[model samples]
Target: MKQSTDLPGLIPVFPLPGALLLPRSRLPLHIFEPRYLAMLEDCLKTPHRLIGMVQPNAVPGRDESGLHKIGCAGRVTQFSETEDGRYMITLSGISRFRVQSEVDGFTAYRRCEVSWDGFDQDRAPISDTDCAFDRKVFMRLLDRYFASQDLSADWQTLEDAEDELLINSLSMLLDFSPEDKQALLEAPSLGTRRETLVTLIEYAMRGGEGDVMQ
Candidate 1:
């Protein structure tokens, strides 16, 4: 088990809008960009194998920092390279960090110094049983949300998923805007994320357009 202190303070960041990687969740990524490919190669050489997944700030004309303040660090768990040199990898979320500042370096991709305070719980995986999720009610809400979006999901798989897994995966896979997804990623806890998830669904069902009310 990696201790919190073992977490790296500096990590290469992948600033992809609309992408959310919460602690204990898995995100599959296709790495085709030259910078990200270099980042991936560098990560494989490091012992931590961590990559920070952050979103571009949502506000228009706000390019002060370009990225949101918070992001989740993911450990590269699965990786493979294709014949065309593209890399396929899966990142397992480790913890959420607040960006301290961008690090200027020779690397092509962005790197940041991140502070991992107040996210100690992320270091330890929560047992699926600890999640106080009411699957039945949430499933009904999800059904309506999915139907309204004209999207289909494998019912059996969703039924079999662990509580945290279901919630986090939905948060990442849903077609919500980058801003909405960032909200889900920044949620303080599993239960809170679940609440935020439900609220977003209800808002969408009601035809609430951009910038969902918090």
Candidate 2:
């Protein structure tokens, strides 16, 4: 599929180092920083509360620091405003973005121009064998992974997940290193992404770093 170039109606972004947003996934964020608070205000006045999610190459600290070349743009699907004037928003991933430029960051938040490229939104297929393996092997390992991390999950809903939901949700939930998340974002196809998630799950279950299977 042909990738999308920067369109006229692009949104500003606050780059959060080390986090990645993959297509079809949902990211829940608590907006507390001042610049991001203003960014949310700007988005509220617009038709779509859209923003790009990017990472910084170095650890994020202080003003005007490290940021990476790529990120994803997401639309705010839901928002709840706190009495203290913060926003708790859930963003639904729409497209992948390449960081074009970053604005000055003297203010509380930073902004950037981004372009979407190389992400396909149409439903991609997963083989029955792959899907079954994804369910059985991946879930077993995922349960082990959660236990190792001392976290608990609602397995009932997770067990009923559709293939796409299963893949995307698991990808988002894993405490993968930044590089692993970036690789998942750059995966060629949905099946490939699913396979990557399964590989990560199994590796984490075995207490290993991400391996070549992804």
- Measured by lDDT, the strongest candidate is 1
In model 2, the number of clashes is 3
Clashing pairs in 1: none
Residue 12 lDDT in model 1?
Answer: 97
**TM-score against native, each model:** 0.93, 0.78
lDDT score, candidate 1, position 41: 93
Give me the displacement of residue 144 in model 1, in angstroms. Answer: 1.5
lDDT of 2 by residue, 1-214 (tens): 3236423235677666446676667899999888788888887787757778876566546545666666777778999989998999988776776777766655456677665644445212332123345467667877887888899998999999877677777777768877777667666666887777777767776778644443
Per-residue lDDT, model 2, residue 19, is: 65
Question: What is the clash count for each candidate, in the order shown?
Answer: 0, 3
- Which pairs clash inside model 2? 17-56, 35-109, 56-67
- What C-alpha lDDT values do all the predictions have? 0.88, 0.70
Question: Model 1, 1-214: lDDT tens per residue?
Answer: 3476788889999999888898888999999999999999999999989999999874567564588899999999999999999999999998889999999999999999989988877877553333578899999999998899899999999999988888889989988888889888888888888888898899999999997935
Cα RMSD (angstroms) for every candidate in the order listed = 1.8, 4.4
Candidate 2 regions exceeding 4 Å error are: 1-9, 59-64, 104-108, 122-134, 209-214
